[model samples]
Target: MQQVKAGGLPAVSTNLDAPKTRLWGERRFRKAAGSALLLCALLLLVSLPFALIGPSVERLVVLVLINVAAVVGLNIYTGNSGILTVGHVGFFAVGAYTTALLTTPPEIKADSLRHLPAFLANSNMGLGESLLIVAVISLVFGVLTGLPLSRLRETSAIVSTFGLLVIVNFVLKGATNITNGTKGIYGVPELVNLPTAYIFVFATIAVAFAYKVSRLGLQLRAFQDNEVAATSSAINPNRRLLEAWALSAVVLGLCGALFAHVIGAFQPHDFYLTLTFELIAMLVVGGKRSISGAVIGTLLITALVEIVKPIESGGGIAGISFPPIWGLTQILLSLMILVVMYKAPAGIMGSRELSLSMFKRPRLSESTIDVASLRAVESRSERPAATLATNAIGIDFGGVRALNDVSIKVETGKIVGLIGPNGAGKTTLINNLTGVHQPTRGQVILDGQEIVGWPSSRIARAGLGRTFQNIRLFSEMTVLENVVSSALARGHLATGVESYALSLLEHFDLAKLADTKSSALPYGAQRRLEITRALALEPRFLLLDEPAAGMNPKETASLIEAILSIREKFALGILIVEHDLHLIMRLCDEVYVLNKGEMIASGSAEKVQNDPKVIEAYLGSQEVRAARRKKTT
Candidate 1:
């Protein structure tokens, strides 16, 4: 039980943190994983009878497995990677058609495909052998499809897939000599029996389960949610998408082969645009990123179809039931998918893995922080004389030296102002200082740690936090969600972690906007929300970049008061970048003037205001000359 350190906690030693463990310790993961397996087994046991007892029910169950495999595979693309792919069924069609040709007997093929090509003409094989052959062959086809289709993005890709589906169908239709044309190929040796089919189904589930916990899956999910953030986190968007594309194609290809072997028939018309939509619906209904959601959704639709089947009246006369109307079930499924999309885009568990406790109450506990621990953290902050020289170090960008080696030193608790005219490079210096952009050449030392060239995220984690010049809140999200997202990013967006985001918002006086959409927020409120987001990271040094940019004079004054209070209360070193001179004069402990990307002067507000260069570059040389002329007159 050696100590482990992660997220401020003591991390365990290498020997104690063995590969046997996952996110948690080995014991916790084992318990959680064991419970998950038990739950899956229980569900399978419960669903087995429905799949075995009746002919129609059994048929639908088998179909469900096939669809589940496809849907689960598709999640790798749509669910985790957040990309839309509609041409997936093209691979399915290829697999189905391929399996039919490979497994069909010569005699049946001769009759069925008297017009078939010579290569496909005398195909014959045992059921097991044919399935094995189709699985391998379909996978090759999947790779071929994925390789070229992955080059496009979003809407272009969607439209591109439609083009592919049409082309594939037309090609299959024209390949009468090989694919038996659109008339259909038959006699596929129906090897997908109940036992064999379920084995394949379970195997597919295992693959999906394994994938969800794998590094690939994590990368896919990260890419889908935030491409920039994911890139910073070392996840490549295009590569991850293509990997998902290839993997999903392979799995769907397996499903296609199984379906072809099960029904012993196929045609170009069977897998067209309509089939593609159905596949998308299955994925959406089950929740995009979860394998269990896909499985559950598949089973639900399958069972619904069976329930709506026409009752030939094993005939008890309470009444006779009829099969659902044309496309009735599909319409219902479509409605269900639409509802889930609006109500909970993350699906039942979002990307959360399923476990036996799906129906159980969760257990929880809390620990108390000792007073000494709090004081230990506070004691680290020294008084004015002993404190680190906290200051806005000079930052320069390409060609224009934005900061001209400007520096500031903080004594105890103080608010500093960084005022410069537009185009004076205030934002540029902030960018370089905050790790958003690297300095052409300079260093940012914090608590004896040199943080130059570090990524913005790493710098932020190192106790330097800042707000953006523009309110870069996640607009589509709620206000609280915006802050919560920041918290999640701070720790890689783990589930079940409490977002003290709301607490920060409350402290900043924006709690009333928690449920409101960020984009809908007014200007003043938006600014506060942005500050609240940065504060959620618990930074030791906070940089405010033009916080009063859009505020009225009254609002600006109120914000200045709030800023001063924050410095005193947190004992935090603060720097403000603003063009509002009144706020700068009153707020900054010391003022630095920047003109055309160079520091003209630095001193107390009154002293810098009187400097000749500062007056010449900023206020107007004419005014200074007039004052001199007046003195002579």
Candidate 2:
């Protein structure tokens, strides 16, 4: 690969670097279109045999396809965001009721005791128009339901969704006039035939697959894996989750409308817990992480359910006498789900997407350092240097002072270190600066504007980024993906982002492992990757907590070099916490010493290192202690 120099460092030449292979846009559209056509062909092929057999078999195929659409919708949220959602059925119910109310003949609606709003009660539309209305209604319900739940912790989030389902169920049963109550709505026209079902299923698959590889999908998965890191990278967890939930809900609603038509009748009980359980089981058994998993799980469980229904009805199978068995399908499905959970917790697909890329290695050019190009990219940020300062910041945790009147300043193009023994509250100070902890008695000023109580995410978006003491790379993602996700944190996902991410990777000597999963990288590489990910935020001030903690001497040296190089390239103000004094002394322009939650010393590295008080803190010199006692007396 050719190399070009931009900022005194050699970077990979633009011509020599391989073009980005994003699974979206033209290439992705082509693949999805092809997949859709292939799916259509397969559905047709599958339908022919059933069609020849009889209309009953063909109808079963159509129902199975509709189920696939619903499952795919559930998978979009559950698989991508790692949130187990049971409320999608609520959206489905909304879609079905909306479609049924609008499309039902006026005579039937009048006889059913119509009490819907005047517009809805009087309206009767074609199947296409009804479905369009369903889409709109579903999206609204999805957003409304998802907003509060998306902000909750995992278990609470799932539990809150149960409440949504219950509310929808109650509403459907209670609203006798509009829904015809528990008795069900009849005379719903069967608009979705096998061909239409095939089209809908194909469309669902296309959307799901596209979403799984979209930028939003990447951010959601990253948020799922590491919330703190994702936040620091400017990924908004609640917002991403809500988006996924809404999209999933809309798709599920469409499925529900189609299902309503297929059955020619429905009740409040149709879209409830049992259907929710079936969808969840399919997702878990087939693997919630991939479209293929959703499709496979849906087909397998659906087939089993169909087979068991006949046995439950006392139909003898292959000379085996069958007797009536209430809830046999539910029992068998439950057992199968339990078995899959025990045998394979990740389900059959695990976290892998079905992609042709998996069959062939990514085509990347031989790795080369592009220090200049990387630096060149940063040179675009010629805005005024940022100034971050804390004025007498202090916080008390249950009356124990974690930080007492601590104040420090980090200006652009400077490296500052906070060093002390393990309990000296070094990290606490960083936390206060980053808005992870709101200082009780001080101002955290960025460019002279106080931001002490701002949320961590807002602080990050305000041009401050941080890395944890323990490496927090989005471990489930590839090295490049981890950085690219960060780069897109500010909502820019243009094609240029890929090159910038690669340049950062190249600068850190990580481009060679661009496609390697972050979890699979060596510890040192993971640490560097974490730094690279943080840097992708384009922060004016970067806070690094114990960045050199687990590094060997060589790794420390390399890290120190990278820190210095990146600082210069980006004109960043850096606040670092490192136990390696030698590396710190080499890298930091100024250093602050803390002891027992107080700043003991602060100045140039040489001045602080030699101060008697500094010496006392590290080595406990008796002379220094005695001198301190004398001064106190």
Candidate 3:
């Protein structure tokens, strides 16, 4: 449902939403994901029938696969958490040496053990056991070291990991008895044949899939999107970061084991900074957010490298008998870099992933509607306007003065309004009630207990939702994406979001512009979008802050009507702050007037309008009205 205006840049990022669906829809997305998975498996099976074209080409493929696995693993930490870590190379080396030490042949192990420690010397195994042990042990190592270190700032995390890499290399170099002191290990068994290596690719893909759907991914993503907002949601950023870092390391460790067995001879020199940078480049060029992007990037870079290898002479173009150009390979790659930089810098796949929906390519049934956000809305029959206040309350903020404390007591909802001039703190009070702002003192009492100073997200969980005075729609994101993102934040990101969003859009008669980028909407539409997003949260108490900010008279009339319609549909207590007196007077069941940051009067709209203080502050008083009357007489 994402929509971009003509010639506007598409964000081109894939975001996975919440989980809920009818059995039929669940079956459909699952079928699509299953088919894509099956097709990829078939291609692998078909490709494995032949031996690699050349040993050089085979090596290139193996290295590319290793790099792809490592890159994908690194993304678990780097992509979702928004940290740039260079320490992944350290984990790669740890995995590499772990496999090498465990899988070397008995004779080679003994011969190399002149100065070895007892445990390592006696521990070498056959290929399968070594690979499995390497994966598990490296995961443990990652959790032990990487988790604790991940709590540091991004730069610090990278530097610390790099230090670990240096330390590991030094240890391997110094301990000739163990790790052969960097002379390198030889005679390691080759268990990863062509087909077995492809199997390793499947392992990495599985890891990617699990990581994407897990709770760790969600916490990390929330942290990446907005750390401040994430904190407000009570996600333990440090813990999530550590878990992702550790998990990524363990998955990369499996790739390292594959690397060790494939080549048979290995050295610490193989996993240096150069290899790390190349791995990062693959990720950047491929599109970081997606595992498939990592796979594609790995393939492209590997193929390019193969083409640049030295061709034995006697290769003459047009019988010139010309020799290969020195570093022509480097020059060619450099030119490709320039072209790619000049073109799509977001990489081949951008941030998009292979999704469950893309395979079926379902055109929305509600073509003009978002159709993805139905769970974010509520129905009117369950909620009536007059009885609204029993479920929802309002907040007032100003140094414990209790500016105004009231809850809608009616069983059927009624439209209640608060009217105040600038600086009257109506907006401040609204923020407190809706959990937007923590009060210096006051309970957002629901069911008679204090829900004071709760985070906006928690308050939102409690079903008191509000909108900002200035629109807070995801500006760069399209209209549907904006709403979808909000729903995901509310923990309802999947199939239900589409159904509810679609239904809500149709109900509000905004179906036609569903695909439009929200930022491009006209002022009135943007206002409506704010309300729509709020309604998406399915709140019982809806606090609207100046929903009529920039509308013309016609637009205002339409907006008022829309508000009334939304009220009936949602069956909620409605509290709004507005400068438009006539509309407020007409729509609000009761009005509260405030001046100088304190509530001064409360009554039915007619009585409040006639109150002396209200007249003096907003309408300029009786004497002023009398003077105008006399002038007219």
Per-residue lDDT of model 3, residues 146-201, tens digit only: 66786687677768877877876677687676677667887777777665666676
Report the C-alpha lDDT of model 1 over 1-633, residue by residue, as the tens digit.
Answer: 111111111111222222222231123345435644653575577567777789877776677667767887787677766777888888788778877887788888888688766667776666666656666765676566666666577788788878878888999999887887878888887778677666776676666655544446644554555543333333345666677777777777778888987777878888886678777876777677666677666666666555544332132225754543666656676787778889988676565456655564432211121111111012223333212242345654445556665555544466767766778877776676666677655466776767777766676766656776776665544565556545544553333212234335555555555656666777998898877666655557777889988999887877877776566545667778887888888888888777876777888988987888877876568977899789999
Sort the predicted structures by lDDT, highest score first: 2, 1, 3
Q: lDDT for model 1, on a 0 to 1 scale?
A: 0.64
For model 2 the local lDDT of residue 411 reads 93
Cα lDDT, all candidates: 0.64, 0.80, 0.64
Per-model TM values vs. the true structure: 0.60, 0.90, 0.67
Give the candidate number with the greatest TM-score.
Answer: 2
Q: List the candidate 3 regions with Cα displacement exceeding 4 Å.
A: 1-51, 76-83, 110-119, 126-187, 206-247, 265-269, 303-342, 353-456, 473-506, 509-540, 545-633
Residue-wise C-alpha lDDT for candidate 2, range 139-214, written one tens digit per residue: 8888887888889878898898998999999999998878888998988888888889888988888888778667
Q: In model 1, which residue pairs have backbone atoms overlapping below 3 Å?
A: 3-11, 3-12, 4-10, 4-11, 4-12, 5-10, 5-11, 117-177, 176-181
How many clashes does each candidate structure show, in the order listed?
A: 9, 4, 33
Tell me the TM-score of model 2: 0.90
State model 2's lDDT.
0.80
Go through the candidates in order and give the C-alpha RMSD of each one to the true structure. 10.2, 4.5, 8.9
Candidate 1 ranges beyond 4 A from true positions: 1-39, 115-119, 126-141, 147-151, 309-325, 358-633
